[model samples]
Structures are given as structure tokens and as C-alpha cells.
Target: MKKELTADSAAAAARHARYGTLPERIRFEDMTEEVESAPGGAAASYDPEGSWKSYSCLALDLGL
Candidate 1:
């Protein structure tokens, strides 16, 4: 049988990927450059919550 993916699991995966086993190692210096719209437009941001209580890549794609 195949297993289904859930939002909580996705969020955990994101957090883990950023911090790894040593969450304390997370540093702003290591973060990606802020996203901005155009050359001098407002910058984009990412939520540690992965954008919601349950992260949905589709929703994020639509700018939800």
C-alpha cells in the first residue's frame, strides 16, 4: 500500500532540512537571500510554519 503525505510531516521536513539535528545551528547568515519582486520591489519572505498550519506546496505556488 502507498502512504499519503500530510502537512505536519511536510513542515517537520522543512524545519529539519534547515536546522538538521542541531536546530541551534540555524543562523540568519546561512539563510538564502531575501526574495524581491523586480529589481527594487518589495522582498519576499518564508514562514517557518511553511505558510500555514499545514503546508501545501500547491497553495504556496498560487501565492495563498
Candidate 2:
């Protein structure tokens, strides 16, 4: 009799195939994360001149 694979089992098999098995001591649920947001907000924090200067191109083409 062939046993049908469940969604969770299929995902677990694929994950093991890609990354191999992880150590038992590591669990994602036990982890804590901290994130800090920009005080001026994302759009207000943009430096257009600084960004454009970083790009290496003979001309800035927008394809317009």
C-alpha cells in the first residue's frame, strides 16, 4: 500500500533535500527579533543624488 504524502511532509522533504537537516537545538519559535524604523520615514530618508552617483553608467536611461 502506497502512503500519500501530506502538504507538511512534502514541504519537509523538499526543505531537507535543499538545506539538509538542521540541529535539534535550533528552533525558530524560540528566537526573538528586533527591528528599528527610520525616524523620517522611508520616502523622506531617500538621497537621490547619493543613489544616482553610486550607479556606474555612461548615461541615465529611463527607457522613455
In order, how many clashes per candidate?
0, 0
Residue range 1-64, candidate 2, lDDT tens digits: 9999999999989999999976789568669777898787988968987996677664545543
Every candidate's lDDT: 0.73, 0.82
Worst 10 residues of 2 by lDDT: 55-64
Tens digits of per-residue lDDT, candidate 1, 15-48, equal 9988888536767877768765586343355456
Give candidate 1 misplaced runs (Cα > 4 Å).
Answer: 23-64
Model 2 TM-score relative to the real fold:
0.33
CA displacement after TM-score superposition, residue 44 of candidate 2 (Å): 53
Clashing pairs in 2: none
Name the regions of candidate 2 deviating beyond 4 angstroms.
23-64
